[model samples]
Target: MNAVFPTLVPDHRCGFWTDGADELETALRRRADVLREAAGEGTRLLDLAALPDGDGAFDAVIGDQCLEHAVTPEQRLRGQHLGVLSRIFARAHALTVPGTRMALTTLTAGRLPRSAATNRALVDVVREIPLWRRCLRPEDVAKACGRWWEVREVDTHQHDYARTALAWLGRLRDREAPLRAEFGDQCYAACLRAVQTFAGAIEDNQLSLVRLTLWRTDQ
Candidate 1:
């Protein structure tokens, strides 16, 4: 088994290590333990798509809630989301050796039945957010991996996600004044609405968090 070294973590600001990005650095500083652990490990935070290292340099990769933004709105409109996702998988394949394990967590459409209008409304609400791309179905993710990876396990965390969103919503509500002052009333309101929408969607089984564990296939 390959040891986990030089692990690549994409979009680290979402409660992960820093990649020298200002926002990420700030986030890392907030988590002193993670900052210290990363420092001790000598981890290098490199861009997923543009790593300067040679191929097969990493032993593992973790993509936490970042795959949704792999494709642009235009690509999604053109029905190329899967292709874009496949390209990202290919890039990861090139950066890891055979038997490397990758763990990815993403919010995806749920199996629950919802009216077409409701689904359309949800899409409209999130479509304008540059980072909030369309959520993929679980099978779409498997297809995106293609022959590059073997899906080891897939787990759903709908209730957990809903609870977390609710907690965030409560915190935002409690800190309304301070948050609004810092981020502006409009931005704060939008953020609150987005969190509420996600919470409701998760609780209604219209959205779910899927965690996938995959092993890199032999090239």
Candidate 2:
């Protein structure tokens, strides 16, 4: 389907792409035909809770880093999880010619640390509200997705994340000047430190990236 921030790294595989940063008119000018527009954040656009009409109603959907930020992490394991996810899946299923597939990739915290400080740090970043995150386990994610769709594959990449973070840190440092020029020192510096922290955490394996795939099954 469409990606919220698809233009981040261009690839020919996507059907529709949009970036939030671009002006609406400018985005439209780039591609005159923007079949459906859903405002608001993330994949949970209540407007399209039901399937759309006509040919472009996509059967196959793909998302990345979208669901983890759900208002409540534990909600996935709760009963509402099925209803919420099912509505989206059913709509996507309707668009496909009976056998279209949907794939979603996301990151989940690998394991919860026993330390209260670490838990609070996670919660703080997750809610972005400077509060401690309620800890979640990997099983929580798997169980949530399992109820509604068949999980075709699951994988995790753990080791090189630290190295990756180091690279990111260096890049942010190098680009700080240009970033500050475009977005001011305050904004640039804030972002630089944030990225640096993320990279540092990943490098230490204190954070992890998890990938999961779900396929809609015909009833």
Put down candidate 2 lDDT per residue, 1-219, tens digits, no spaces. 022112211221111224344432343243212222111112332223234665443444554434544425455446454445555555555555434444443444454466786555554444432111322344555565543456676655443344444544565577767756766776555545544545545555566655455555666
Question: What Cα-based lDDT does every candidate model obtain?
Answer: 0.64, 0.44
Per-residue lDDT for 1-219 in model 1, tens only?
A: 011101111222223323344344454344434323322232433234344455556766667667776767678778899998888888888887655677677778766546786676566556534444567788988999999988888877675566556656776788889877776777676666666776777788888878777777895
TM-score of 2: 0.54
Indicate the TM-score of model 1: 0.70
lDDT of 2: 0.44
Off by over 4 Å in 2: 1-59, 69-83, 114-141, 145-148, 159-164, 181-184, 204-206
Candidates in order: C-alpha RMSD to true structure: 9.6, 10.2
Pairs that collide, model 2: 59-96, 123-133, 162-203
- Residue pairs that clash (backbone atoms under 3 angstroms), model 1: none
